[model samples]
Target: MHKTLDKLYAGIGEAGTGRSGVGELCALAALSANLYTLVCVAPWLDEEYGSAGELRRRIRKVAAALVCRLERETDDLERVRGVNALFVLSNTAAEYEQKMLDLAEPVLGRYEAGRLTAEAALFEAEVCRMMCNCYCLVQDEALAADARTIISGWTAVSPSGTEGLPVGVALARCEAAAAYADYTGDERFRAVRSAGDYGTEEPETICRMLELHLRCGAVSDAEALCDRIEQDAATGTDRTSQVYRLAAKAACELLRIKDAGFSE
Candidate 1:
């Protein structure tokens, strides 16, 4: 469930709200989606708790507040504008079943959608910045590997099996792929394929590929791509270029680590 929450937050963070109204709407939708996630997840908690009904009541109170907030914020927008919002809601709800099974775990092992949704509004302008920092903090060796493995497994699963699963599985897969590529050297893990049925074209996909090249000691290729990406960035406001710049920085870090005689 925390994974779901994190992904939704990440999307809103990526949207960069202060830049445009569309971005703000995306944040609202991301938050609202987390609320909706709680709605579906709370019902199951009824069967799991000693005071199941009471716990559900509390959870619903929070969920209802979130839903009402979303409705108020997004009512003026058309269906197209609400697409990301809807995605957020469904993805959060999808994690409910699995979270129920983890009730006994320490640290609760769940992301609070309700709380995250609330925070999304309070920190709209800097959401993405904070998300990147927060993720960097929590993404240790074990957590990074787990996140990657789960995403790889999720993307590789049959569509038929994923039926009635969260609709945002693709987005989740993308998030996981990004982290996996950064923290681990496993290049087989890719995001969605291209339209040519060739290879992944997702913005983050470029980062993974760049990182993979660096990991394999393909410094020349990585350096060349970095140069090309810098040329693309010169025009300004290119998302792909921004991603490439980050990847290039990572590649440079890898080079330094190697120069320092870091070993496997």
Candidate 2:
């Protein structure tokens, strides 16, 4: 569930709100998603604490407020955060589900109105992610495709050095690479395939890169990464078992890929 929360929060943090601690609201959304998942998967937690319902209310209220906050945003990145958070927080709600495209258009309009700069291109990638998720929530395949087209172009160039990108940009690219693969599969593997190097080296990032390597017929890279993770795990890398588990998963994936004749 935390994994789900982190994935959802990327879009939110990148574009949740412009106010001070806008990132906190992004966290609020992640908390809500994780809690909701917990409650669904383990109903006892919900019955015992009664926190899930309250958390849900808080997420919805804050997300809606952030959405309203976006109205006055003139800055591209801040508006991106607000807009991204809005849909993520309210995506499961039926009333707000239909508003995705309408909500996204003004931002799209802004992009189409002006030429893409290096800065604008960076933000545009994040915006496309928001659109992709919103469209998936609403089952709007057409708009999702439109967003994917934009994503493909940006992702194809694989920010090899990724300098000047925002702090969370690498994580965002990880998500983008996953999403691109989700939408296009083999036909767009190059566009979606993560470089597997550079950016953040946190366990989560490494886990994702391993997944990408196995995903794109780069099993040897995944195997090599698994060797490193095995050492990290043996070193008692952290309080959590994520790294160890990711190592096991990577090793398993390598075998599976090998058996399936997947290689680069």
Candidate 3:
């Protein structure tokens, strides 16, 4: 882990010099994602390296560089890749949510003008999903409404026969619906459940569903999902082990809530 952190630090330093290309920008963005996840799951690393705020500033610098280079990028594919990287960074850096949306305006405009390629459309869906998640986190009602509008627009004209596009759209819709439910205190998980299939295999997706169920007073349903997760964990694969660990954490939280007399 130290070696990986060393590499991330070195890469960030090199990318921060303002001489990096689009490829370097994308690589730095990936590094930022890894760093963000590590800091989240193992916060002790912050004491070992630097404060969380410092790490975030370093990453935000890389994101800024990525956006600057993307402006001069002439290749459609590279521009999309750079923009996607920017979105990934923005997703982790919640403080930059509005700035990220502002940066995405031109891309959204192009999408609205019906000029995006298949790949760009997928990227647009991701942008919407990330922004929705960010807005929900901060409880930004106004921006969340704007995100809903963008998502609705995308869904109305979403292309067919494009592999993975439907799944992307489904996840985006789930995020939007989840946000609405949270803000209004109206349990909308049932509607979101019927929105589309968010893959059950992914631990993060399952955790999200578990959260929605608990929030909507579906304790039995949440427990059933936890049981399924435990069964998958019994398979003994490393991935399943990780899933099981997450499931255990969720179960513990559920127990805590129940013990505190917060009945579903």
TM-score of each: 0.27, 0.57, 0.48
Off by over 4 Å in 1: 1-149, 155-221, 238-264
Highest lDDT model number: 3
Error of 1 at 260 (Å): 12
Ranking by TM-score: 2, 3, 1
RMSD to truth, every model: 17.9, 8.5, 7.9
lDDT of 3 by residue, 1-264 (tens): 344444444533444455667766665565555445555555666665455676677678778777667767665546655665676677666555565555555655665577765565555545554445445545667646665665556445533212244554454355445555565464523254323235566554565555556555667666766666766644434432343334444453444445455566
Q: Please write out the lDDT profile of model 1 over residues 200-228, one tens digit for every residue.
A: 33334344445445444456655655555
How close to the true structure is residue 124 of candidate 3, measured as C-alpha lDDT? 55
Q: Indicate the TM-score of model 2.
A: 0.57
Report how far off residue 218 is in candidate 3 (Å). 11
Instruction: Give the range where candidate 3 is weakest over 10 consecutive residues by summed lDDT.
Output: 188-197
Give residue 251's error in model 3 in angstroms: 16
Each model's total of backbone clashes: 2, 5, 0
Q: Using lDDT as the measure, name the better of candidate 1 and candidate 2.
A: 2
Give the TM-score comparing model 3 with the true structure, all chains together: 0.48
Whole-model lDDT for model 1 versus the true structure? 0.35
